[model samples]
Target chain A: MDLENQKRVKDLTEEYGPENVVVLLGAAEGEASGIAAETVTAGDPTYAGPLTGVSLGLVVYHVCEDEVKEEFDPDVYDEQVSMMEMVLDIDEIAEEMQAIREEYTKY
Target chain B: MKGAGYILVHTPDMITHYGTTQTSERIVNPESEYLKNIEANLRPYERVRAYYPNQTYIGNITPLELKEIEGPWQDLECPVDERYGKYGEIMPQDEFYLLIQAVDEFELVFLEKSFVEATKPKLEQDPIITPYVLGRIKEGVESERIDDMVASEDAEGLYMGDKLVGAVKKAHAFDPNLSAHVMVENLVSKASSALALMYAVKNAGIDRDEVEYTIECSEEACGDMNQRGGGNFAKGIAEIAELSRSTGSDVRGFCAAPAHAVLVAAGLVKAGIFKTVAVVAGGSTAKLGMNGKDHVKKGLPILEDVLGGFAVIISENDGVNPELNTDVVGWHSVGTGSAPQNVIASLTTDALDKVGLKVTDVDYYSPEMQNPDITKPAGAGDVPTANLKMIGALAVRRGDIDRKELNAFVEKHGLPGYAPTQGHIPSGVPFMGHARDGILSGEMNRVMIVGKGSLFLGRMTNLFDGVSFLMEPNSGPKEEAAGVSTDEIRRIIAQSLRDFASGLVEAGE
Candidate 1:
């Protein structure tokens, strides 16, 4: 992450607490393998540093892992340190994600 | 049943090749986060059977080939065991690239001169699609102009791998009204719809000028900030396909938009408002690889790569084609609660009840048929199966079938889902062309298309949305025309005048 975005992400994490701060990494505009707009939420095992921050880069967090996913490990994967794309209200983001999941979920 | 185009554009899988280390180098900050930790050795995406060539994807197979495909191409296995069938040929990536360029040309998507020069030969050599390319390609914009425009940030280039295939120039310089992203998206939407319409015109045996109106039901919004979602994807598409006499507009309801459009188009044709009306949709880029992470994790190639588009034409009931049973309409009203069972019952059982039809009366049900392969690894289970089982359960509760007969009911009524995950593209419209063929051939008595939407996504409302209608074999004799003919009016007027004159003479005497 750039110094400017790094500072912004740090400030956000401080304000919202590390548990609530979710980071999303967007593949640069022309990457061949990963989807250009693929997004992964940062948390317990997966949240690490050395994030990618480009245009439309941002952070989303203040997530309750229990409510959102049964499990999330940022550390098990490469630590993500992407630039803050957009810092959304964590609860709202969770609700939206949950809604999307429910669309395909059976009753 | 007019025509359908299920196209597949195979992309090269260079990006998915595992064991290749890719490093991004930044000069200013050599240790930039993007350079330091992006996944280097990524697995290459393999071409799946469904993506290669088959009847399910209308594009690889032409309308003629599609006509030859037997009904119920989807296997009826408990878990979908196969993705590809023996119906159509799989188009290779290079050919698809040329096809997309041809499509761009058809829509007047200008390319830099050098780019066109490099690509022109590849397009010419392809015997299969050469005719299409020759028929569509027009004049090219100079590469110098493209360079200048890109330098000035006035255009966005269309990239395939590292190659710059084409670019979208800004429609206007000072029009914040037309941002680059909006222009690009609209351009893509327009080009795709045009390709589908072209196929439809040929497949449906209808002249381009015969279409009187069109409805573009894609989820993409074309207009600017002042009127964000205000659109005419219909007019843009009609213009491209040379629908000389057609006029059009757009309707949006997320995934349910196509079903709503179908209902609207059917009503228009049945009411004699127009001889032929079309409901068309183009795919979305945002949805491409939407579930990629899960697929990648499970060692599965990204299946959502294809940008899906479809077009359905509703025309005058010619006794041979299937009729849109307008009376048997289902709606998910505002008060219809959001529970899954409630939604299924409201959109299916209740509507069928109103039409005096039992749950088992309909031969087939097409709900949100998102391909399970793409959703399953993502932890979103078999969506089509879930829908079918719910309908079966409802049938059981209504005494339409025994509890033990639910699996049989599903097997009889449902087919494996084959649609891409483009939100609106999969909502009950993919199977329309097949359904039309079945009904016309006397193989299917009734097929109901159910379109459901999550209205709360818009943040303005919490209510869920849905609309469904049945298509059946044309029970001969068209529904009454919406208005009386001029000759009928004249006869009525003449009789009334005579009666008045006779009454006047009698009173005078």
Candidate 2:
């Protein structure tokens, strides 16, 4: 969400190539109770355990529910199981954050 | 003829989502290992990386890369894990649905009306499926139609859990000639084979029509009452892939079919019967989850969920692509005992000896490359490793290599097995795609593909079957023969006839 975090994601994407990047959203399974999103690319320091217990992370590619309806396999991401907040486009969000940082620095 | 393309489709749903369907029920008998261990095994993953997009599987990685990787490959860390190679991406479940839909040549397979509606957009988004195949998909069939068909036991519905995803209709109305069960098996084989054909066309950049002949060498049988195994899977797949000019027949030899088929294709080319011949095979649904119980018992996911398919082309000397060395071919003679040493010797050493080469002549050897991840848990041991060791032991017996060098021999000549145990799939053919690349790239030369089969399972014979062939770098342009014209041949025949007539006249005088 922050500019620094956006840069971190962008750097990771660049390392694995944008096409190789897969955005994973974790399910609330064990101890925790919220859908948490994480980005997986080629290089990462380590895996930050999911908010819940062991979770088979789901791929969250689309940003909106309307977009998901058209392109997503409901079997892969279900309302009963998957969390919505986990859907973040690292590339798109990173670009937006970069623009905001540029404007702020100009001021 | 110019090139080869290989594709592997992973049907994870067959393991997790479609487990309740009759197909699964048929495959998973009550006393079967998979069914008994369902409660213990980890849920199958939604996707696996090995069956990734074309770029990941075909374009990104070459056979050289796969061969170069040192064995006991699983120990290699991620991104590099034997499970996660550099080349292929693990295709998602939705993509597979789109693929099966794309390759549905006839109206036999119907996507559930609701599921079709739900997946249309995703299908549209698919990058690999041809526009023609994708365009054939229409609005879903309604629930009433699917329900009536299911209720009447007229159709077998494809499922992703309780929800209906698709259904396959029977080919015949009254005759058991085309029952729903036979129709489904044939369709799956056809669809998968067609996909392999499509990939061959894509990878080779050749028109489907250029494939003059096809040879289908899978373990599945497709025929009616009169002739059970009397089949035409090759033509069925050719029809689906729209190779109107190609005609073909099926080759059956249990697991050894692919190798035998390759030899057949090479011979055809060598004899100038066909300028271009493609050897292809589709996957078997019957073998799905075959080792699931063992995997589940070991707290592992069902590794045998993927159906494997491959297609390789053998054409006249292209001077570019690898050549199928016709001089050296291995066969398991009737007298060749079933001992491991004998089989390996006949398949490797004996064949090489004819060419004045030793067992170590081949830089790489591919023999029944069944993935250890799946086979080890099932107590079959590491099949590929065992095969390499057997070959090494044979080499030692021949004094071709030192007994102490057996491990090094295996390490040098054998590769980590990555093929599924889909009977014929785990045979030698899985490595052909890579072997072709390796030869062309000068990464290596003289790779041998050995296929072995159990004929006893057929109940008609107690014999074992196997055949092997070597693939090597092109020797350069073949010397062309100054061919005689038809007119010249006609003149020669006339002169010979005249001489015979003159001789008869002289004898009468």
Task: Indicate which candidate wins on lDDT.
Answer: 2
* Model 1: docking quality category: incorrect
Tens digits of lDDT, candidate 2, B95-212: 5565565655557777667677777776566444567677767677777777777668877766664566776777768657577656666666666777766766655545677788
Best by DockQ: 1
The candidates' interface RMSDs, in order, read: 18.0, 24.1
Which residue pairs clash within candidate 2? A30-A53, B49-B90, B52-B89, B56-B87, B56-B88, B57-B88, B63-B434, B113-B140, B113-B141
Give per-residue lDDT, candidate 2, residue B90: 33
Residue-wise C-alpha lDDT for candidate 1, range B365-426, written one tens digit per residue: 98987777666666455567667887887677667899789878877888566677878888
Score residue B360 of candidate 2 by CA lDDT: 81
- lDDT for each candidate structure: 0.59, 0.63
